[model samples]
Target: MEGATPPASATATTPDAPSARSAPAGRPAVVVLSSLVARGSVGGRAVVFALERMGFPVWFLPTVLLPWHPGHGRASRHVPPADAFAALAADLARAPWLGEVGAVLTGYFGSAEQVEAAAGLVAAIKAARPDALYLCDPVIGDQKPDGSGGLYLPEATAIAIRDRLMPLADIATPNRFEAGWLSGLPVGSTAEAIAAARALGPGTVLVTSAPAMMHRSVATLLVEATRCLQAEHPLVEGAPNGTGDLLAATFLARRLDGMTSEAALPRALGAVFEMVARSVRAGSDELVLAAEQDTILHPMAQVTVRAIATPKPRAK
Candidate 1:
């Protein structure tokens, strides 16, 4: 049957595996499980598109479907039933071509149970292909309107991500607030952010919106087992959603492309910074990812990166 046509149902069920004749040689697929919006780039759409643009085929699984981001006013939400979601995840986990997935990037979940399902799939992927990388973007909480940090998702959901997912991540991208919440340590200063990021279970943690050294600037702090790095850029007021998602996706793509964590930091940050600045200048509420595709491919924005001494633990 190598060259013969297969049955219609079998063809429908079978994944269209990548081939040297079709897909880019040596580029493995990225599986992105997160929220999906019909409008605006965020969650799975953001991750999938970023990876695809980098010439990687992406397997996208939507955790929840929305007309648009929740911030843009109340919209109809569709969260799949728990059992159905688990069944779908199990199906993917058992796929014959699962090894095609070289990395997984997960973000927002519709429910705590979905988090558990995602964890199972991650475990399965690792078991099937030990070298697979899992990048967990803990999208549980953020700073509140009252000028304080807190969890936006249900307490149980946050707990599931912290306990079940983060421990499995090779890389964790948490905004400053989520970092503080997950690490149970204050992240008000750069030192605190660096310490907390290291304490997080992942081998590498990228804390977006970390404290900046320059006035009117924001920073993305990367903490690893060996060292810590920071990438700071001027603040873009009225910046829109999807920046964090875009950053995480771009960084993962670059790392998969053979860049070191240190080497990839500025390039990924610069790309997002350029796209975000362009979007803001155009007065768009969403990232102009399509319009500024070149920026994503080759960032022209300026970003300054420096290494700081990793904070040592206090003596007992």
Candidate 2:
């Protein structure tokens, strides 16, 4: 992995995931798969931040190291060549963290080779520790509209995820657009989102950005075989940059702590709403670091989290 300087402005000592609210919690180590843009986003940052707060040892295996973050145009960019996989494999061949490692959480990847490499890492982890949980947050695209179709995940990379990475994942977190692309389902409503999640080959699926068009709200849809759940929050009108990453992180953290999606879904949704509310209050991005940390301590401290019972399936 890479740890380069991205074009965006930098943050603190942690270099990549530095935030005051991001205190370390005594939890297991969760590895993040992404291109570490130095001092980048709360998506990447928040995951590492939140995990660290919970005391889970977090390590980032960036496919590339960016100067800043991908969210901002000014963030500098650096791509680790496709050949770096072998070196990564070798590095993992004898890292002490490998023995203590318990879970793997992958975010965005730049190249197909990186995707393959990430898969290799997952395989190695599982091989070494059979109980290790692999969580794949198919971080392709966020709320970008202009033809950045299907998560902005490269076609080849998407294929690799579907064919290789996904099945190995114990949990998969995908937003609306991503679920459509990954599961071949429609992205219109909550039901569609649930259907898409059910198709991803994993029992635990977290689908975000699922507010129905008729209502100006944000929705997180969770589907687990017979029991489906949905949580909705008032839509924040501006800047929703890093909620996906945060949600992915929150869900992973909760699950790692032995909370099921059914139970963790409410907490994750509350956290997302709290982050957005904090950002709006602070005049910042959708996922604000300071507020995010507070949300972790008190998810419901800001916004109320309500879980609605999912209705039974209707006749096809």
Best-matching candidate per lDDT: 1
Indicate the residue-level lDDT of 51 in model 1.
Answer: 86
In model 2, which runs have C-alpha deviations exceeding 4 angstroms?
Answer: 1-26, 142-151, 301-316
In model 2, how large is the Cα lDDT of residue 283? 78
lDDT for each candidate structure: 0.85, 0.68
Error of 1 at 62 (Å): 0.3
Candidate 1, residues 110-225, lDDT tens digits: the string is 89999888888887777656678999999998894367757877989999898888888999999999998898999879988888888788999999988888999989999987
Candidate with best TM-score: 1
lDDT of 2 by residue, 102-174 (tens): 7888887787777776776777666556677888988766554464544565788878777778788788888
Q: Give the range where candidate 1 is weakest over 10 consecutive residues by summed lDDT.
A: 1-10
TM-score of each candidate? 0.90, 0.81
